[model samples]
Target: MGAVTGDQTVDQTVVVAVDGGGSKTDAVAVRLDGSVVSRARAGGSSPQIEGLTRSVEVVDALVREVAGVAPLAGVDLFLSGLDFPAEEEAYRQAIADLPWAPGALLDNDLFAVLRAGTSAEAAVAVICGTGINAVGLGHGGTRVRFPAVGAISGDWGGGGGLGSEALWHAARHVDGRGPATALTEGICRVLDVPSVPELIADLHFGRRSQGDLRLLAPEVFRASDAGDAVAGALVDRQADEVAALVTACVRRLDLAGEPFPVVLGGSVLQAGHRRLEDRIAARVHDVAPHAELHHLRVPPVVGAVLRALERAGADGGALARAEAELVGTAHAALVGGVAR
Candidate 1:
């Protein structure tokens, strides 16, 4: 059921799909029969995280690993950490040497989340992982997005942001600048340090890398589950933040009062941190009352595959088979796949 291009059939089509994110990249070469030809992974390639050159290097390396010497019917890339049109264009130009580049399409990774989460013509997706972002696609090709480039873009709600908040409250509590709470001692306990001053000194002097701070995100969830007031507040704030993004996307796309899906993706959201999930669901319901909540269980690369099939003009039946095949392989690959 592929497009009738000189009588070519669906089984003759090939697809090279890529999903690039802040923590890692996943590339898969899928055939029209819904069987995978190759799959590969590499480190983070987001231009917003690493510079353009390094981002290109990371993405290209993975693409080559999966797509070497393969003829393709189409290529689709869904990437995170691209903040604006210029950034997407720059990345597109940088990766133009791939065999299928002339026929390829590039899009934001949140769209991948949306595609992976639902088959609906209109939906919203919010990814809360190393960083946070959202995108909405409505009927008739309407699209909405955010800069998602940190506070300057007025965006937030990722593991990194949540971890930073946990540290901020703990530090403030130690200095009598904030309310006393379990986060102060919980942070010290996790770090195995004696007190807040010592930890602050180590962090300030670069003795402890600031990047390791994200490790505290799990501790925050744990504290919240244990009824820690400070941790609970931070979790609640994150829920509100994500719900706000989804609400904005829903409203902007005119999806209000509809039973459209609001897909959740990334480690922070997919972890099913019960309290956070409940809060986010409740918050989203408050605004978009009929929005259905879906957690993306398959890897985002499945979304990329779906896009590739769409580009190839494969029928919906082929899409269903391809998705199922990709989902089965995704489980096995995930044992070794690097997830953010």
Candidate 2:
């Protein structure tokens, strides 16, 4: 479907774009000319975590809340937990059945990072958030990706993984099985436990959920910054994993010699950790010499809006306007509570 333009009424074409991740989902409705009509934020909507039905329900609720009285021309979704083709097709059919729009475009959330980071025709995006994943677009529409289903999929070095590692080392140290480090103190402080054994008891006894371990990731970084040997090693390993993902994608897509944008995003990468960022850059440069690294500055949801606009044959001007407006709206929502 093409975007309605100039002479046509603005209300004739409205698109709702959503970026659904492991922690939260963001949705926005926009006119053909790039004006935002409405937006909403909701909790995590990953199919793998919440199940297909519940995930779709969360997204559908956000879409309706954003679309409101507007007649949607199309809907676009970039979501997490769609690791295989069957999952993608299932979600496509489910979303297609929704009456909110006539058609929908869907893909993994990594593409949102790619689109948000650059307009390059060929690019790679590495997301190191709660989990780690990557996607690459190459010449002739060639695409590369990872299963990204955690350790079983040979993936590692996300916040969840790092946090677990921190706890492991801390536990080992407390038990005299490993070298002492600041992580034990850091983890105990962050979790508000007096000792490692107490923290262990709490988790084992169900007083603390396993998911709470992710909260220790930042403490790992803090200890690393404070010159803790174990934390520094963990940070280095994370950098290696992130770089490995980029190297694999670039090689698989055969974009190693050609210049392409390598987009870095997600909470871990975007946390402004100089040590991690520098290590990643140096490692990526070793293999993909021509690859340019870009840290995503705006919300990945903006990329969903750009993709929808592109599908509708929007011009460069319209795309730029949409991006600018969406960035402002996201900032407003963050600070002023206007779009939540």
Best by lDDT: 2
Model 2 error, position 284 (Å): 0.7
What is the Cα-based lDDT of residue 253 in candidate 1?
84
Name the lDDT value of residue 116 in candidate 2.
Answer: 77
Checking candidate 2 for backbone clashes, the offending pairs are none
- RMSD after CA superposition, every candidate: 5.2, 4.7
Q: Where does the lowest 10-residue lDDT sum fall in candidate 1? A: 331-340
TM-scores, each model vs. reference: 0.88, 0.92
In candidate 1, which residue pairs clash? Answer: none
Relative to the true structure, how large is the alpha-carbon lDDT of every model? Answer: 0.80, 0.85
Backbone clashes (count) for model 2: 0
lDDT string, candidate 1, 1-340, tens digits: 3545676644534688889998899998877666677888888878877788998787777767787766677778888877689988888788787555786788888777777777677888889999898888889989888888888889776878987788889888988899887877877888788987898899999999666667678889998999888899889999999999988988888888788878899999999899999999999999888888887788888888877777777766656677667676444333211221
Local error of candidate 2 at residue 83 (angstroms): 1.0
Q: Which stretches of candidate 2 lie over 4 Å from their true place?
A: 1-9, 329-340
